[model samples]
Target chain A: MTGLLAYFVFFATIATIYAIIVMGLNIQWGFTGLFNAGVVGFYAIGAYACAILTGPARDTLIGGFGMPFLVGLAGAALAAALAGLVVALITLRLSEEYLAIATFGIGLTVQLVALNAAGLTGGANGLYGLPRPFWSLFDSVQAFNLFYLVFVVVIGLLVWALLARLVRSPWGRLLRAIREDDVAARSLGKNPVSVRVQSFVIGSAIMGTAGALYTGYVGFISPIDFIPILTFQIWAMLIVGGSGSLLGGVIGSFVIWLIWTGSGTLLSRLAPPDLQAQSSAVQVVLIGLIIVLTILIRPRGLIGEKSAVSSKK
Target chain B: MIQAIADGLSTGAIIALGAMGVTLVMGILRFTNFAHAEYLTWGAYMALAVLSVTGLDAGQTGPFRFGLGLVLATVIAVVLTVALALAIDYLVFRRLRGRVNHITLVFASFGVALIVRYSIHLIFGGAAHYYSNDLQIAWLIGDGLRVMPDQALVFALALLVSVVLFLFLKYSALGLAMRGVAENPALAAINGVHFRKILFWTWAIGGGLAAVSGVFYGMTVQIRPDMGFQLLLPIFAAAILGGIGNVVGALFGGFIVALIEAIALLWIPAGYKIAVPFVVLLLVLWLCPRGLFKGSSGGSK
Candidate 1:
């Protein structure tokens, strides 16, 4: 019973981390109508930042400043936000498709650097032994996991509240206006470019925070963790949940993670040893099918845009 | 240096084929199909299945791996890929058209790409397959430069196909209709140009060409599920750098991008070669958003 409880707690914690990412994506894609295809890049930057800052100092590489956990988290958010600023400045002027491609490129570049830049990123082997907050305070693994779950839940709630408030504000209204029609928004004395940049940075910062939390939970960082597929997964989740709604982001993240983990477990149990490796291929195909089906059935997503209905009535 | 150029041109040939298809689709459909690369993968794998089924993997002909069986398989693969492309359009793209915006289509393409890529992986098991495993000694031309006969074949075929496609597009009535639709779909529709037929033909041609490129790419490099998807960036870079809808621009863009990649190996480590297209894309997008060509319409306007 305890084992099952612990597993649920662990699962919930990871799901919450993803929820954080989904919410961030919601802000950029949903609220601002910015199509960021390279989400994993910012997530990777955040993970690396936190891992480097909080982990013990290394001898051969540039990272391992050994800062506190909060500092690492802050660094992660700042680094991702900075990267977002750079991407937004360069690609925002172009149309949505170009911006998507450019961002995808940026993500790929970041992954390449992580894989190849041995001196800075520790290369493919990646950095390990990232310090988890308050790990030493707890006696048992279960206690520590429970503590972490509660801690992450608190942060998730805080982010959710903050984003919910932001999305309802006048700033959020302007973002939607810009998203719907940029020229009209511009004509109305609103600078869509600056506002988009702001939203991109903030959303990226949130993704970075999720990365930091992920690193803390996993206790390791690697280039393999930040593949383009990660971006696809997040997009799938957002699409499944509904793009423009914060509530959808939260619910969608948890539900998708549940499906992901649940199916993974089921696949492992069902498939024999020879076919087990191919199960991941099946999982991805299923996810892809889900995405296509969702687009077909409910392009607006499960929860959809709450603001539109509320404002219409 | 000569070897690098040779390699660049050969690779550029394959990229050009893929880019031309992509550019054509972008011109007519008016969206960057993220799943375009998957057609290449499907073509390669479909050929692989044929090769395996026929037990012709061992066949070699004329100082190259261009066996008769593989040749036949390539034809079959082209038809199969074109059918798949048309089916995808009928099922997904056709339904979504005019209902959703282009960005939604883009995302849908992403989903489709994932489905195709992983479906290939599920079947093919992620192992790289070669059309011919035999290694051919490169002929030393001069100045210690070596060139493969296979590479020569790739270059020639690419050139042949490009010219044929160019001529077909220029002279054929359907080609003119395609160009009209690309330029202005609504206007073309008003003028009684069959928009749906043009779209189907464009995708068919694009898919068929992609199949050839995929087979050539598999022959030169190796066919993995991720092969075409990995090359997507380079293909897009080629298309955009050449100018989105311009076939000639795509052809040149392919060569330029490939040449840049091959030569950039001199300065940066080979591990960073993947980022070269990205950097080139950023530079192109920044410096000349219209691409290197003028009057080649159908971009993010």
Candidate 2:
């Protein structure tokens, strides 16, 4: 029973971290109408930044600053925001599909850099020994898991509260105005490009925070963690949860992560031993089908966008 | 350098075919079809299936190292892939045409791409498979440069088909109708061109072209389930680096991008070769958003 509880806590912690990432996506894609197909790229920057800042010395890699966890988190977010600003400034002029493709390319480039830059990223083996916060307070594995879960949940709530407030602010309305009709916003003297870039940077910082949180909990970072499939999974969660709603982002992460893990366990139990290895591939197919089905059945998502000022299409 | 150029040309030929199909869909549909590359994967698998059933893949050939069985399989692949493309359109994309915005359609296509790619993975189990297991030595053309007959055959076929395609677009009645529809759908519809027929024909031609490329690609390299998805970035770069919806431009874009990828290995580590297209894409997008080509033939003819 304790083991099961510990597992749930572990799962919830990861889901909460993903929830933070989803909220970041919501800010960019849902709020500002920026089609950022490179969520994992910014996430990766954050993870690597934090790992490099907070990790212990290693012979092969360039890390070993051994900084405080909070400082590492701040540096990670800053690094990601800087990357977002540069990328957005370069590619934000392209409309819709072009923008998506450009961002996806950026994501791939970042992943490639992480994979091949052995001296900096520790190569494909990944960086390890990143410090976790408040490790001294916990004695047993269960206690540590429970403590981490609370820590992540608190961070998730703080992020949610901040974003919820931001969406209701004037800046949020401007984002929607630009999204619904860019020309109208431009006519009203709003610099849509500047605003869009700002939102992208902020959203990227949030994703970076999530990545830092992930590194804190997992204590390891690898290039594989930043694959395009991670971008797909985040998009799926946001699509399933209402895109424009903060509550939906959190809920969707938990629900989708649950379905993802639950299906894995269920498949392991039901499938014969010969086919157990193939079940993960089946799970990917299932998630993909669910994405299609959700887009078809409920494009607005489960909770739906609860915008007060913006008119519906 | 000559060998690299030869390899680049052969790879570029396959990419040119794929990019042409993508440019077609982007022109007609007004959305980048992310799932278009999966048609190539399906086409390769279709050819593999035909060969396996007929025992033709094992058959021997002459100097070219290709057999009559492979040709028959390619023909069969074209038909099956065209059908698959049409079926997917009828089931998913047709419904999405006027209902949602283009971005929504793009996300839907992303979903479709994932489904198609992973379904192939589930069926094929992720192992790499080749059309011909026989290895042929490259004939020496120079001191260092050698050319494979298969590579020559693939490029020649690609060039021939591209010429035919260009002529068809320039002269044929259906091609004129397609151009009209791409330029202005409402105006084309008013002028007695059936929009649905044009859309169907677009997919048919695109799928058929993709099958040819897929077969050639499988001939050159091993076909894996993820091959289509991995190739997608380069294909997109080719289409965009050439102007979107411009056939001639996409052809040039393919060769340029491939040549760059081949040559970039001298400067960067081989593992970073995957990023060459992306760097080219970012540069092109930043400096020349309209592409290097002068024609912006989309929607205005």
The global C-alpha lDDT for each of the candidates, from Candidate 1 onward, is 0.88, 0.85
- Highest-scoring model, lDDT: 1
| TM-score versus the correct structure, for each prediction | 0.97, 0.96
- Which residue pairs clash in candidate 2? none
Q: Which ranges in model 2 have alpha carbons more than 4 Å from their true place?
A: A307-313, B58-61, B299-301
- DockQ-based CAPRI category assigned to the predicted complex of candidate 1: medium
Candidate 1 chain B weakest lDDT stretch, 10 residues: B292-301
lDDT of 1 by residue, A166-269 (tens): 98899989999988889999999989988998999999999999999998888888998888878878888898899998888888888888888889999999
Docking class of predicted structure 2: medium
The clash tally of candidate 1 reads: 0
A253-287: candidate 2 lDDT, tens digit per residue: 98889988999999999999987767778888877
Give the alpha carbon lDDT tens digit for every residue of B1-301 in model 1: 7778889999998999999999888877888888899999999999988988988763677777787889889999999999999988888988898887678888888889999999999998988888776888777787888888888898888788778877888899888888888888889899999878998898898999899999989888899999998889999999999888788888889999999999999889999998999999999988997789852555635
TM-score of chain B of each: 0.97, 0.96
